[model samples]
Target: MSLTRRSLVEYAAAHFGWRRAYGDTTEIDSLLNEQALTAYTEAADHAALATAKNTDALAVQPGVLDVRGRVLADVLYLEGVLTGARNRGLDPQLIERLDAAVDHGHELTVLLADTVRTTAAVHAAS
Candidate 1:
């Protein structure tokens, strides 16, 4: 399902324990940005998967900036945000999927971290 700001923020506040609210929303805004970026990147990855293409579009083109690292950073940040998002809410129907989403986020973070670290190591060793 598509994520809306209300859904995202409410979900975070309800499930993620975003209890702290000051006059300035810098922290929440950062979280929201991370969530939106993650959602957008995840959707693009899904689309690429459906089309039988490389999920990381950056991996497809040479000299295209290869934003895999940046994307992976966002994914890693997103996992934390999502973990918080699922911290509170409960639903027999929705809980399973939400759990899976959080799990997926975690797995993505690990995978990306490993890949980036390995790549960096290789580059460093060279």
Candidate 2:
């Protein structure tokens, strides 16, 4: 249901439990409830950019994931699907969601890193 750049989310899930929520459901929730709307938006945009000459556009790296939790290569399922994606057709909406997940995953990673740095600095100063 989500693409995570780091295992931090898995750690959080284990710590909080899969179904537990620490904040408002709208802002935060169990991974099951996490909306990750930005992921959807980005994947759609990426799909639109996929071309016969540019299968890379549909690629989901280790960093991004489809709703089903499959990586980009798995999304295509068959090798021929990837080879002929431009001619066989790939779903733009699926690509959009994957791209969005990657974008948001990166954003969350940066935010988490900054928070950790700031907290460490404050603790050291104290």
Candidate 3:
């Protein structure tokens, strides 16, 4: 299942405890831009596992969530680092895996934050 803004935000809000208003969206961006790629890749690798059907996508359900949760944790842990990098005049290129449709600039941040909040609200409902 591809991650839609509404779905992902809602999932984050509910499963991740993020609020739609004034949500901690930086965490999610960082996860997508940095941490989650690895887990996403790993999840992809397990996609072919026949026994993984009990989970959402692939691998054992618990294992899939575990990987995703680890990525989320990494996003949380690296908050200070990402900020510091930005403070140091680091305009690091975003990972290529991020949606090309999503801008990676200040303007994009504002838009993305709103989208995240909206999704988070939906996730909360679920």
Q: On residues 84-106, what C-alpha lDDT tens digit does candidate 3 reach at each position?
A: 66577565563222223222333
| RMSD in order of candidates | 11.5, 19.2, 16.6
Candidate 3 or 2, higher TM-score = 2
- For model 3, the superposed segments whose C-alpha errors exceed 4 Å read 1-60, 92-126
Taken over the whole model, the C-alpha lDDT of each candidate is 0.60, 0.49, 0.52
**Cα lDDT tens digits for candidate 1, 4-113:** 76567767797866764546677668767978998998887766564675334334332122344555566566666556666755455555666566577557656665
Ranking by TM-score: 1, 2, 3
Instruction: Provide the global lDDT of candidate 2 against the true structure.
Output: 0.49
Worst 10 residues of 3 by lDDT: 94-103
Deviation of model 2 at 111, angstroms: 0.5
Model 2 C-alpha lDDT per residue in residues 15-50, reported as the tens digit of each score: 886733446654355443444665676778766665
Candidate 1 residue spans exceeding 4 A from truth: 1-90
- Backbone clash pairs for candidate 3 read 9-119, 9-120, 10-119, 10-123
- Better structure of 1 and 2 per lDDT: 1
- For each candidate in turn, the TM-score is 0.34, 0.32, 0.29
